[model samples]
Target chain A: MKDSSVAQRTVFFISDRTGITAETLGLSLISQFEGIPFIHVTLPFVDSAEKARETTQRINQAYQQDGAQPLVFATIVDPEIRSLLEKCDGFYIDFFKTFIPGLENELKMASANVMGRIHGVGDSNVYNTRIEAVNYALNYDDGARTNGYDTADVILVGVSRCGKTPTSLYLAMQFGIRAANYPITEEDLHSTQLPKALRPYQHKLFGLTIDPKRLHAIRSSRRPNSQYAQLAQCENEVKTVEAMFHQENIPYLSSTNLSIEELATKLMVISGIERRLR
Target chain B: MKDSSVAQRTVFFISDRTGITAETLGLSLISQFEGIPFIHVTLPFVDSAEKARETTQRINQAYQQDGAQPLVFATIVDPEIRSLLEKCDGFYIDFFKTFIPGLENELKMASANVMGRIHGVGDSNVYNTRIEAVNYALNYDDGARTNGYDTADVILVGVSRCGKTPTSLYLAMQFGIRAANYPITEEDLHSTQLPKALRPYQHKLFGLTIDPKRLHAIRSSRRPNSQYAQLAQCENEVKTVEAMFHQENIPYLSSTNLSIEELATKLMVISGIERRLR
Candidate 1:
C-alpha cells in the first residue's frame, strides 16, 4: 500500500460547464494549501446518473487502491446528480453550497428593501435575465454591422494597435460582454471629442491606450517597419488619443502591461456590469 | 461627501496580459466576499514606470474623490512597477505576492532534493516557457489539421459530437496546454484501443464522453433527424465507446453537463499537468 502520509490526495472537479470554472476556483483554493500533495481530476458534463455512478466508482477505486480519501470539488447544478455524488466515499467541496447561501442572502436583503424601482424583480429572474443579456451581447455581431452602438454593454475606445481587439474578444468570450471597440483616429483625436452619438452613452465608454513603443512592436510583428508600424507615429498617435480622452474626461485603462482578463474584469466592475456566471 | 459605508470602493486589476488573468482571479476572489460595494478598474499592460505613475494618480484621485481607499489587485511582472504600486495609498493585493513565496519555497525544496527534475529550471524560465507553449498550443491549428499531435502536451480522445474542440481550445488558452484532439470512430471503438502511437503516451491521454441523449441533442443541432443525429445510434455509439474505454482502462470524463471551463480545469488536475501560471 502507498504511504498515506506522502501519497498525493486525489481531487476531482465535476461540473456542467466543462469544469473550467470549478477547476479555476479549485486551483485557487489548492494554492492556499501549500504542502498538501493532491492530485486533481476534472470530470466535466457528467449530467446523467449513469455517468455519476461511473465517476463514483472510479473515485472509490482510486481511494481503495491508494488507501486515501480523495477530495471532489464540484459545481453540479442538478439536484439528483448532486445527491448521487454525495453518496460517494470522498470529501466533496460543492460550489453550489457557497453560491446558494450567498444568493439567498442577497435575495432576502433586496426583498426587504423594496424602495428601488425594480425592487420586486425576483433574484432568479434577475440573474437569468442578466445571463441571457450577456449571451446576447456576446453573439450580437455575426458579420453585418449597422450603427447600433446602444446595444453594447461596454464600448471600448482606443487608438490603432492599442490591444483593443483581443481585449474585446476576451471580454465577449469570457464574460459574455458585447464589447464593441472603435479606434480613435488622428482626426478624432484632433477633434477632441467622441462621436456625437456617443455623447449620451459616455457612461458606458471605456478607453484603452498603449505605449507607442509597445504598439510599434506589436504592429511591426504584423507589418514590419511600415509607416503604420513606425515608433514615432505610434507614439504620437497614442499621446494624441490619450490627450483626447483626458480632455473629454473619458475614463481609460492602459494596455501596456495588463492581461485581457484583468482589463475585462476591471471594466465589468467599474461599469457595474454584473457577471452572468460565477 | 457620500456616507462612508455607502460609498463604492475602487478596485483595480493591473496586469501584463491586459489584466485578463488578474481580472479572472480577482472576480473569483470578489465572489468570495459578496455584498462588498467595490468598483473595479483594470490597468492592463502597465509594464512601465510612467504607466504605473498614471495608475497611482488614478488611485489617488479615486481615493480623494470617493473618501475611501481604493483596493488594488494587480498581477504585474516588472519589479519596478510593482514597487510603484505598493507605494500607492490603497489596499494592494498583487498576484505575484501570493505566488512568490510559494515559488521560492518550491525552488528551495526542489533544490534540496537533488533528484528532482525541476531542480535547475528557474521559475521565470518555466513561466515564460509555459506562456510560449500555451500561445503555441492556442494557435496550433489555424482551423487546419497538421501533424502537430506529436508536440501536444495532452491528446484528447472522444467520439464525434462530444465536446473536444471547445475543451481543447480552453486548455490551450487558459493553462497553455498544447491540446490536440482526435475523434474515436466506430472502427477504433470496435478495435478497443487508442491510436497505436498514443499507447506510448497513455499518461497524457484524456477521454471525453457524453450522455447519448445529450450527444443526440448536440448533433441534432448540426444535422436534424439524420441517422448521424439519431438517438438510438448515438446511444449505441456512446455505449460502445465507453465500454471500449473501460476495457482499455483509459480514464475518461463525461461531457454531458459540465462546462468547457470545468472540463479543461479537471483535465489539467487529473492528468497531472503542472500549471505554469497562478
Candidate 2:
C-alpha cells in the first residue's frame, strides 16, 4: 500500500507556550502541498536556552535519519531562544518575528513582546465568559431543559444524530456563544410543525439535516439492529424534518459533508449571532 | 472609561472558506500589540470575484472611517483573488501566498493551491474519529458511567467543579482524544487511598487541582450560601485530594490560571498521549 514515489518530510511546531497557534498556522500552510507526507513533532514549552539547544539537536537527528532538512515552524517570542532555533540544521520559519515589524510600523507603537500572551489566561473576563458558555451548552443540551431557551444565543434543531450536540458545544467552546440543541423527535416530524417549546424562539433557530444514508450509518453504530437505526426510519425522519424547516422559513444546512468548524462558522454567519469572546 | 492613550484600529479576516486559520493566526499576531484596541470583522465563504470586490470596498470604507488603513489578514488561495485583496486600502498580510513558494521549492512539486482544504472534510475517518471522541467525552462526563473507562485514552480525576469537564471536552473536540473525567466525591476524598475503580488504571490517570479560593468562588456562583461553597470546606477538600494525588504518585497540574487549551496541551504532553488526528 505504500507509495514510494511520494516524498516524506519531518516538521516541527515550536512555541514558548502551548503550541496550538503554531501548529494550527503551520498545518494550514503545509496543507497546500498535497503530494508530500509530513511527520509532525510539536515542541511546546521550549522557553529555556538549554531546551532550545536540545531541540536543535533533535532536528539535526531528524535530518540525518530522513536525508532531508526538517522544516521548523516556530512561534517563539524570546529573542535569544528564537535566534538559537534559527541556527538549527533545518529550514526555520519564524511566525512571530516575521509579522511583528509590519504591525509595529502600522500601529505606530512597539509590541509588548510578552511570552505566553496569546494562548495564556489573558483577560479574566473573557476566560470566565468562555467557561460560562461551556456550562450553558452542557446544561441546555438535547432539549434537556426547555425553560432556559430564552437565554440561548442560538437554538439548533434537527433530527436525532443530525450533528447538533457537537456543533452546539463547538459554538460555545470556540466562540463563547450560548448554543442549545433540540432534537426533533419522530412525533414532531410527523406533526409538520415546530415543537411547542421552540415556537417562541423562532428567531434564534437554525436547522441541521443530514443524508439518510449517513444518518443510518451513524444511528446503526449507536443502536445496531434497532428500529431507530433502520434506513427507512432515517429517511422518513430526515424528509419530514427538512420539510418542516423549509415551511417554517428556518435557515439550514447539510451537516453531511461539513466539519464542526465549518458548520459552526456557517451557522453563526447565517443566523447573525455575535460571538461573546474572541 | 475608554483609555485615550490606546490607539484604535479595524482588522479584517478574509478567507474563501471558514476563515478560522486566518482569524486565529491574525489574533495571535495582533495580541502582541497591546496598546491598540482592534475591532475585528470576519468575511468568510468569499469564493467569488464579486465578493472579493465587495470586500475591497468594505475595507476602503473602514479606512475612510478610521482615517487609517485597516490590517487585513487573508488566506485566499486563488491567485486572482489574492492579488485583488492586495490592492485593498489596508496593510495586507497574505498568510497563504507569502509562504507557498518556500514550501514548493522544498517539496519540489507544485502546490495544490486548493481552497478550503485545510479545514474541510478531507478524510472521513478523521472526522468520524473526532465525532466519536466527542460522544465518548459526553457519555463519560462527571463519572456518569465508569464501565467505559477501560476504553478511554485518559481519565481526568478532580474535585467537583475543578475544571475536569471542559478540559476533557476540549481534548476530545480539538485533538480527537477519547477523554473521560471523574469527580472525586467527598466520600472518596475522606479515604486515604485511590478510589476502588481507579486502582486498576493508575497509569491512565491525570489529576487536575485548583486553588481553594478560586474553587470556592466557582462553586458559590453555582450554589450560593451552601456548605459546599464555603472557603473552609474548599480548602479541606483540596488539601485532601492533593495529598491523595501525591501519595498515589499521579501526574497533575494546576488549572487555576490556565485556559482550557493550555490545560489540555500540558496534560497531553505530560501524559504522553498522542493525538489521533492532525
True contacts kept of each: 0.07, 0.86
How high is the CA lDDT of each candidate model? 0.64, 0.90
- Cα lDDT tens digits, model 1, A1-278, are 58555656677877744555466545544544445576777676687889889989988987887666777777666668888988898766665554445433532332221111111122433433433443343333221242666777777788876756556655654555666767677666667677665677687778888878878877897799798899888988888878778987878888675555556666665677754433
| TM-scores, one per candidate | 0.47, 0.98
Candidate topping lDDT: 2
For residues B1-278, write the lDDT of model 1, one tens digit per residue.
47665667777877643454466545544444446576877666576789889889999999897776777777665667789988998877775554545434532332121111111123434434444554444444222343556677887778886867656655654565777776776666667666665676676678889999878876796799899899998988888878777877777888765555556666765777755443
Candidate 2 C-alpha RMSD relative to the actual structure? 1.9
DockQ of each: 0.07, 0.84
lDDT of 2 by residue, A9-80 (tens): 899999998998889889988888876779999989999999999999999998887777889999988999
Query: Which portions of model 2 show Cα errors greater than 4 Å?
Result: A1-3, B1-6
Model 1 CA deviation exceeding 4 Å by range:
A1-152, A155-174, A178-206, A219-229, A236-251, B1-138, B141-143, B147-151, B157-161, B180-205, B219-251
Model 1, C-alpha of A47: deviation from truth (Å):
20
